[model samples]
Target: MFTRCWLWIGRLLRRTLLITLSAGLASGAIGYCYYSLKFSGPVSAEEQIPATEAADSRAIIEDAIRVVEQHRSDTRVLRDAHAKAHGCVKAEVSVLSELPSNLSYGVFSQPGKTWQAWMRLSNGNAYPQFDRARDARGMAIKLLEVEGEKLLGSRSEQDFVMFNHPSFFVRDVAEYRQNFAAQANGQQVLAFLPGWDPRHWEVRHLLIALQTLSPAPETPLASTYNSIAPFKLGPIASKYRVIPSPENCPSYTPPAQNRDLPNFLRNALYQQLSIDRVDACFALQVQLQDPTHFMPIEDPSVEWDEALAPFVTVAKIRVAAQDFDSREQNLFCDNLAFNPWQALPEHRPLGGINRLRKEVYEAVNVYRHQRNQQSQTP
Candidate 1:
């Protein structure tokens, strides 16, 4: 079955490659395509919907571990899926002074409360690559000195993870398993193929993957990111997002094109925080799920209709002027791990993908920390 899938992918790539090359000379879309190819928003106001576990979830997690371990073996370094770190900077997450009753939950429960944080911006790639390469971007915020028992460990910290896109490509454990298997074989394209398994095909997923791997952002601070999966916000469920304050954050235009400066994203960030001494601000907003509507907890691929439930700003994230590019700081950022499960029970991660993450993320985190000879977070 795998051989047959490989042959089909080979044939498709062969045809598409030629057409892409021919079309590249004119459109530049295909030209950009020729250069390289790669790589959610989440919300809700209704009651918390519990997630169901797939029978094969354990096997799927094991397969994911294998995939991560394979990457570690190949690079001789343990790393997360989002392996390329752009930068990690000091910041603060401050709950707004006045949030409505419905919006008041978990971290936002105490209005005006502030928690110091570390924000790590990264490329969502299996390996470190040029920043110019088209891929998904990540913004992981870890709040420190938070007074709550974490779901993962006995840490007084909380983590909120987000991606630039609104929805995830993989819907369930089965699709996730297929994706990891493809990654294990070093053929990510196989995960998006029409018929990786004879009985199954994922055209929508393939298109979503293509869209997810859209153009890289100029600077990490200038882009909006969504928590593409749903999570608990006390009694109700919600999806949160980080929206950069355009008025406060300056847009960065590199002196040279992306081709000339492969690490332009990092350079842009450095310029804003270090050289320019500009402070960056972002609105932390949440959209509650509606119980009347069908917001599938099992399938993260289906985006909840934002029109029905709008996001309300509940907090602000502010990054003051500071240099985070030093070797010590970068190493600390590299060693740090962020997981949705590293949160209060009030903000528990939902859905099969998140459930899968509970196991898969832990396996990789433990392995990576062990390999690096570092202590696990308490």
Candidate 2:
């Protein structure tokens, strides 16, 4: 009777184990199928810009620059006042790594290894007393080593960029402007939603979901970084991407406090430099299809058809260990401006938002820099 009971119990256990294994396998397969269907789409070539549109874009940018210069006096005073209100600190720094081969705006390569770089890391909002921990961070890098045809005679090759989610909030220029206007108009909530808000829901939700899955600051940075701008490549155009290697540097759980993020990243970077002299590499990818055939250009809310133009590794960017934040590294230089228009003729930025940027970026930077300089004089 005992032997018979033992045989029955073994049969029951085997059935339960088999059922669980089958369920797990089924779930995984379904998930894989869903993603495969989602990201894999068809590819096509991009369209050429009409002559009228190109001329109009250039004129708008030129006019805007002129207007900005006219108001430079008032802008300077306002900037000085702001600096006085908030104790401004300045610092000078240098780049420790070599730039990628295709770093030039065009074929013109500026000569110089060492560059006087300035940077500023700040929250998205303009509140001076805002908690650094709670706000989104910004990073700008200005290379004093740059030389080119002066866009309004500025001698610096400034890349005013930021570290937000991997993808951008908007896909094209028109949407980017609308989103910018909303932010400037004190509609903070509008920045996060669709209609009046410029935020891309898909990208935002994906990021929020990622945070819930792994609530860490480093996780977002570790993933791929992309240039939302539709950049030109010969006759083909694409959105650029930079992916970090997870193989060398494994992802870690982030500490709870928000303010600790910058420091944590700084420390991690320092530790890597101390040991292996860390090299962060990202490859450039381009979309080879007509914008109209895939995603809507004016809507910053939706993602481009990734299925059409899968990311192909083109260039590699490697950042070395060096203190990026120092006293002389003011926010202006450190928070380098990266305009889509600041490109080679081959990689000219596409869409309406990029056209607007050719003006807005130049105006904002010139205004901000002029003010900072005046305040430093006294």
Candidate 3:
């Protein structure tokens, strides 16, 4: 009887050991999968370029900067005008689940499973425009309540992203300064600046002219925008994009003469809400190649190769329908600041142009706000 009991006890102990070993193996596999997806996925090829080519590119950027300084003066005028025209009232604010379907490339870092955000939609231009024109659309988003060490500065959770088109008139900081100079000084000075390429100037002029023509009369709130900056994500970098989804309303282009763009956009948003809730999902795309791979860091004229790393959708943004015409919503949307420098350590802006943005954008914001306040007092 004693011998039989010992054998049964030994068998039960063996079964327990086998079960424990299986559970440990399973847990190890699960942990490895999680780490691989989060860290190993975004690694990219190293970027390299020739020295002579880089020097030439630098010269071109220097010339562009000179041209911009000669032309652009008093950069704060337009921003102040925008603030005043829109009034000082704060707009009603709310958190969104996802971005609209039409605006595809919006990404925001969430803290504690919640994203704090503020957005403003406006007609894009320097100032003084034909109200009936097909103006460029502006969408500025500030993702607040973020938790992370900022890329360059001391501020935490301060990131601003502004977008117009896939490609920008100038690619780096020196060129952007030159472009601003041209705008400030008007077209006459820009015509004489050495190395002032007409083709390049034309692109910038054309964008401004288009903005002058495009007016958001019908659906002022419905238009979408993008961030043209090339940003780094861990070892990989990409340009951020945003689009408006057409889940509810079929996608349709407006007529040439869109006189009621603002109202049309407002009505469409309202209609979607009245029936079923509307949702906007912004897709995040990363560019695979580094800056040194295709073009020099200074020159904005050369286009980067898009085939290597195509855009991938990573996150979704949703906004529920509500009355946007209220005074509260206007104030929050219009006055809230958006800066690209507000970013996580993984995603930082690259190249000289991005560096200059840190100074120029902040200065512009401060100057404009000050001017607006001064103008309002009796």
Which candidate should be chosen as best, given TM-score against the real structure?
1
Q: What does the lDDT read for residue 336 in candidate 2?
A: 39
| CA-RMSD of model 3 | 21.7
Please tell me which predicted candidate would have the highest lDDT against the true structure: 1
What are the runs in model 1 whose C-alpha is more than 4 Å off? 1-55, 73-76, 193-199, 248-259
lDDT of 1 at 136: 91
Report the lDDT of model 3 for residue 158: 42
lDDT per residue (tens digit) for residues 1-378 in model 2: 999999999999999999999999997898688656644434334433344655555554554444444444443422211111111122233222343444332321332334443333333333333233343433333334456543434443533343343344554444444454555566654544656443354344335323322222442234443445565555556555545544434343333334444445444433443344444433333444454444433333335666654665443334443544345534433223445455445556666555656666766555555644642211
TM-score of each: 0.81, 0.52, 0.58
Candidate lDDT scores, in order, read 0.79, 0.44, 0.47
All candidates: CA RMSD in angstroms? 10.0, 10.8, 21.7
Per residue, candidate 3 scores C-alpha lDDT tens digits across 1-378 of 999999999999999999999999997887678535633323233333334434444554444344333333355334422222222111222223453333222233322134555555554554534444455555565555456567645444545465444555554444454555555566533532425564354444345434434445444334445555566655555565555545533444432333444334434444444333444334333344454355333333333555654554444344554455556554444445556776766667665556656555555555545644533111
lDDT computed for candidate 2? 0.44
Model 1: lDDT of residue 242:
98
Measured with C-alpha atoms, the lDDT of residue 165 in candidate 1 is 90
Deviating ranges (above 4 Å) for candidate 3: 1-114, 128-131, 151-160, 188-224, 248-277, 290-303, 372-378
Q: TM-score-based ranking, best first?
A: 1, 3, 2
Q: What is the lDDT of residue 313 in candidate 1?
A: 88
